[model samples]
Target: MLRLRKSILTVLLAVFTLLGCVAGPSLSAEKTALVVSVPMEGVVGVSLENYLDEAFAYAAEEKAALVVIGLDTPGGLVTSMRGMSQKILSASIPVAVWVGPPGARAASAGAFLVMAAHVAAMAPGTNIGAAHPVTASGQDVPDKELSRKITNDLAAQMRSLAEERGRNAEVAASMVLNSVSLTAREAMEIRVIDTVTPDLPSLLKWADGRKVRVGTVDVVLDLKRYEIRTFEMSPRLRALHFISRPDVAYLMLTLGILAIVFEVLTPGGFVMGTAGAVMALIGAYGLRMLPFNWAGIILLVAGIIVLVLDLVVGGIGVLSLFGLASLVVGSLVLFRAPGGELLNVSVGFMAGITLTLGAFFILAAGAVWRSTRNRVTSGQEGMVQGEGVVVEDLAPGGFVSCHGEVWKAVSEGGERISKGTRVRVVRTDGLLLHVRKVEGENLEEKGAGHK
Candidate 1:
């Protein structure tokens, strides 16, 4: 009986030990992996670069399992694109680029970024490619040799990234060489991308249990128990993005110049001048982010100078008209550079600013011209042609009231002007007025004292 009891106790202990071993790994795996989602929209500039850097840093701090970039850009500066690509390539964790939410494209520089990712994906209705280098104005690169160099360099980059990610390198190079585009299905069929998922959830689900190379080691994504957290741009970054736009920057530059010019012409309250300086500084920051033509800037400055000259020299609207023309031309060419196509300025905004500024300058010119032709109203010369009554009889010289003030006077032709007689001032000699009596008026008809 003792031996049987000992045997049963041993069997029970063995069963419990086996159960503990089976449930141990499952309990440990219950911790959810943090997946960080970063939204990349609009032009890829310094602002976007900064945002991405911050996002990556934050994800690293949180020890995130994966960093997913939700990309939707129409391409942007090449320098910025390269900066962003480097960020992705150097990431500590696995980076996935998803061209998503339908109706989005990964064109130009965006194509390079997508290729740089460890796992590239796209939504059903999305497309990628069209990365041939072009001038800022959207025209073919004018210099054939330079164009070839850029094309080859970009093609090499695309091929290198594709080969590294085990995708079709030749097809990837075609995007830079021929500007060829592909739909989600085409991309999947050609193996240019890993997956074609419709949304974030689908993409995450597909990524589950997939093995990807992180640094030098193969890290299998255990995302079945994953929690996604979206990271957004801070207010400062949002403001930077807003002002980085070519149109917004151009408008700020225009308004700044106008305000400063107005302050210079009026020269009183420094309100316009201060505001103008601030706007100009902000606009200048935007210009630094974009590739701008020097000719356009020169023309814009020249236009403002001409407008100022019109105000100072009081031209008969000719300078104002010329200035308006210069402004229109300058604005049209302001952002026409190698990557200028991405910096799109609205046609309606351009037209409206041109017409409104033209009318304002024309009217201002007219007012200045009219003022120049009119008689002086606030100086020694203003006393001339003013009417007054004599306070004391002018026996050669006497006191008379003119322009609401008493002035010593000498009658013209040295005639005697009686007291209380209304007199007209002919000229001013120092502080004395040269007066002449009205032919039809006497002291009885008019009041003696000036009001």
Candidate 2:
């Protein structure tokens, strides 16, 4: 609940910063300027890479006065982050990277991007630093030589970005080397960032006449323009971003299986099957976009197949047991990419899902198999040897009340029976039942109807 509130506040701050920045100014006084505000949130990925390309291109072509980016991210791929920084560096328009909404922090790769911007700003509650590199598992590089190499290279990167932006390069190096961090106020005091802003109005007002060198030309920012246009990513990107989280993506894949299972359980249904297929596809796409292990996927699928077969073919807990093993092994290594700890899913979550699904399949299938072996308790065949009261006298064949139903009965033992006398069924032929008297006498009646 707290996370949700934080996210909402961040969004509001970003939106207000863009829309209300430099307000109270006459837009028509000078030339009309288009200010493009782009929100860059979440972990960096191919989706982010594409969004950046689109935003930067549009801003350049439109000749916007300001490109305000509301950035709140934990950090992501170094490669993607580097490409984004390069895009900002080469852009003809000035880029303002703002870490905002009080609780927001630009750690790791985010810090690199923040320092690379032409104008770096932050809200009071935000912090920036922790540019150290770790493996996908969130551990220092196991190889000592490799660890030193990556650290030095990354430190160089931080220093270059900070120096280029005219910020504090030494402090930037410490962020990478020592995993140091600074609040918005401290960062500004140390000259690591240009300024601190409480809100969008203050940021824009402060930024009004700042001159920034873009490529080969020095451009002066004019914030007199009142029009603020926000460019959002495509719907496709939005969908991808939503499922990019390790937990959500994993759930999509696992839940997709249950949907398909339900469809199979209730065959010929269209909705569940289609939904399962689509969810699985989207989940698979999300995995492919991340650092993925194909082996894990194959094992996971194989486990599901085995479990399904066990249910269908009535395996005595054998196939399902093996399936459980496969699931456990596959899940552990599923998202173990190069630096997978950054995108790690909880072990408890994976184990619980696996156990729940396995147990359900085993219990439900075993119950069904047991039910098929139970004795037949209904129909005419079950009525053999059942005792009934005679409704009419039976000389050879007459109606007898058998199992609460009137049946055309014949005396196979050649016994005479009176009306209301109890008789036991001997056998059945078509709709007729052969009977004998309770006294062991042969019952016979001439009439078919007993009245």
TM-score of candidate 2 on Cα atoms, chains taken together: 0.70
What's model 1's lDDT at 166?
88
Model 2 has an lDDT value of 0.80
Question: What value of lDDT does candidate 1 attain over all alpha carbons?
Answer: 0.87
TM-score of each: 0.83, 0.70
RMSD of each: 3.9, 14.1
Across residues 1-451, which tens digit of lDDT does each residue of candidate 2 receive? 9999999999999988877666635444477667788888888776887898899889888878888888888777766777888998988788988898778888888898888888899999999988777654455667788778888988998899999888899999999889898999999999999999976667777888889888888888887654678899999888878787666677788778757876887798799999999888778888766776777777787788778878778776788889888887777667766544233245677788889988987886787678668765567777787898778778877889876788888887767778877787888888888988886433433333443
Best by TM-score: 1
How many collisions per candidate? 5, 19
lDDT of 1 by residue, 1-451 (tens): 9999999999999999999999999987878999999999988888999999999999999999999999988778877888898888888999999998799988888888899998899999999998888765455677799789888988998899898888999999999899899999999999999999999989989999899887789989888888899999999999999999777888888888888987888898999999998998888889888888888888887888788788888887899889989988887777777654333356568678878888887898999999989999877798899999889999979999887889999999999988888899999999889999987666754544432
Model 2 deviation from native, Cα RMSD in Å: 14.1
